[model samples]
Structure formats: structure tokens, C-alpha cells
Target: MDEMTWLDYLPVLGQGAWVTVQLTVWSTLFGALLAFAAGLGKLARNAAVRGLSVAYIEIFRGTSLLVQLFWLYFALPLVGQAIGINLRLPPVTAGILALSLNIGAYGAEVVRGAVQAVTRQQYEAARALNFTPRQTLFRIALPQAIPEMMPPFDNLAIQNLKDTALVSLISLADLAMRAEQLRNYTQDSTTIYTLVLLMYFGMALVLTAFMRGLSSMVGRWRPAQR
Candidate 1:
């Protein structure tokens, strides 16, 4: 066979890139939902709700994401078997779960901080208007907080994108795994790795731009702080 050139590698790498994109998109979407839920939960009046949210945020944030991924992909099934349940997840599902949980934990703090930063007066105004706590949070607090959350959320989104490479460890054919496979077959480490680096950079750039636009849109809804 003719020696595979860089051009020849594009198709395979592109496939891997698509998988990486899917992982990032799904994980980030789910992570954002978890972040809002847990973040707000931690501030809830219900002790049990607050405790559960705290526990989730701490457990995922405190642990190594790589270990979490391994535990989900490798250990959970064995635990399930011992308990007479089938808990095995597909590699892609496992990867998304781990990434979402990990990023969500960190993003939870961002949500909590931003919400808390909403001036006390805002809450007072809500109370004056007879707004229920839920009304206060959704109508007054989150709208303001979301704009603040954007910058950190953008960082987390990019971090999540890069972190998708870890899924390759579970034999998900994401970009990094594809690069490794190509390197093994081609023995052209320099070219393959360089291309991989460039590809990741390109993806990050696009994600950053998207996040910025989202941030701007959300910021428009933020009422001017007194």
C-alpha cells in the first residue's frame, strides 16, 4: 500500500472528531441541567434537598474524573452483577455520564456563586412583591445570575470538550483514540499528533465563539443592578 499521507488520515480523524463533538455537546447539555438543579438545590429551604445536592456536588467535584470514568465503565457493572442488576452502559453513554457529572459538579459552584451574588435587595424586592421562593429564583435571581455564570460556564464547556479525550480510554473512537490508532498503524507520531493538536484547537475556538454569543444573548436579559 502507498504510504499513508496526512491527507489520507483526514477521513478517519474526521470520524473521530464527530464522535468527540457529540460527546461534548451531549455532556455539556446534560451538565448544564445538573448544574442548575444541584446549584439551586443546595440553596433550598429543605434540608434533605440541600444535603443531597451538596453530596452530589462534592462527590463528583472531589473525585478524579478519570477515576469516575473508569468506575462507571469498569466497576459499576461488576457491582450491578453482585446486586443482580445489569448496569452496564455503552461506552459512549458511560463517557457522557462521567463527563457530565464531573463538569456539572464544578459548574454547580458557578451557579451557586452567581445566584448568591444577586444583591440581597433583589430578594427583598421579590419578598415585597409577595413572590414565592420559586418565583423569586426563576424570575428575579436566575436571570441576573445567568449572565454572570456565562464566563465560567464558557470555561467549563471548553474544559468539557477537552476532557472528552478521556473517553478514548474506554475505547470510544473519539479524536484522541483515533489519533492513537493512526499513529500505531502509521508510525508517524509527529504528523498525527500535530494534526490532533490542531484539530482540538480548532474545536475549542468554535466552542468559545458559541459560548460568547450565548453569554451576550443572556446578558441582554440581565436587569441593571442598582
Candidate 2:
């Protein structure tokens, strides 16, 4: 077989990278939303709300994301058939759902911890201003806690990006999957894997820079000064 140039494999890998990026972006967005909702739930006055949130976090955190992905893509269809319901998910949908749920579980802990770390003085001040618990949480506690949350959130975001590779196992055509295909076809495992590894590293660096900028902005956001 003739030695294929890197250029020969670039297009296919580029397409795969696009899918991976989309998965990472969408999953992170949804996951963050879930994180906030569940985090707040953990602190809710209602026992039922707190119980439900704890259950969700524990269930997802306890399971492997790969198994979650498979359950959604493969097992759900069978379960649906048994129940006479169409619960089948497209590969991309399943991938995004699994990634979002998995990361959201872990992220909820970050959210909870950061919010809880807010000083008692801040809460007392909010109360002195006649703020309800909800108002205090949203307006005062959150604003102060957000910056503290950023570093952990940034780490979780990077982890979420790497986890997108698991979707490739379900045939979602992500970067890792594309690299595997190219390696099999060209029999250049070293070259294909090295490039794939570099691509992932480049993405991580870019994400780190973006997170740093966001963290800086958050750190500078002083409501009192405004």
C-alpha cells in the first residue's frame, strides 16, 4: 500500500470534529442547566424536591456513561417494544442525552458546593433587606458564588468534551471513530492516532482559554460597584 499523506485524511477527520464539537457544545449547555436546577433543588425547603434531586444525582453519578449511552441507543428500543411505546432515540440524540445527564450529575455537586460556600453574611444581608429565600438565593448568593463555580465548571466542561469520544462507540462518527476508520483503511495507526490526539489537545487548549476569559469576567462582576 502507498503511504498516504495527512492531507488525504483531513477532510473526513474535519467532518468528525464538527460532530464532536456540536456534541460538546450542546451537551455542556444542557448539562449546566440541569446542574443549576438540581443544585437548587438540593437546597429547597421542600423535602420532596430535595429527595428527587438527590436521587437523580446519585443515579447518574453511580452509572457509567457508556452504559447510559448504550441503554438509550440500544436497550431503550427493546424496552419500548415491550411496553408498546416508541422510546427509540437517534444516535446523536442518545449521545447528547447521555453526555448531558452524566456531566450534569457531577456538575450539580459543583453547583451545590459553590453555592453552599457563600458566606452566611451575604444571606443575612439579603434577609435584612426583606429578601425572600428565593430572592436571596437568586440575587445575592448566586452572584457571589458564580465566580467560585467557574474553575470547577471549566474542568467539568473539558471532561465533557473528552467524554464525547464515547459517543463514537455508538457509531456517531465523532473524531475518535473517524480516526479509527482512517487507521483501519490506511493501516497507519500511529499517524492517525497521533493526529487525533493532537486534535483533542488543541481543542482542550482552546476551551481552556475561553473558560479563563469567562472566569475573569465573572470575577470582575461586582454588583455593588454597578
Against the true structure, whose TM-score is highest? 1
lDDT of all the models against the reference?
0.96, 0.92
TM-score, structure 1 vs. true = 0.97
Please, what is the TM-score per model? 0.97, 0.95
Off by over 4 Å in 1: 221-226
How does candidate 2 fare on TM-score?
A: 0.95
Structure candidate 2, residue pairs in collision: none
* Per-residue C-alpha lDDT of model 1 across residues 67-92, encoded as one tens digit per residue: 99999999999999999999999999
lDDT of 2 by residue, 10-91 (tens): 8999999989899999999999999998988998889999999999999899999998899999999999999999998989
Which regions of candidate 2 deviate over 4 angstroms? 1-3, 222-226
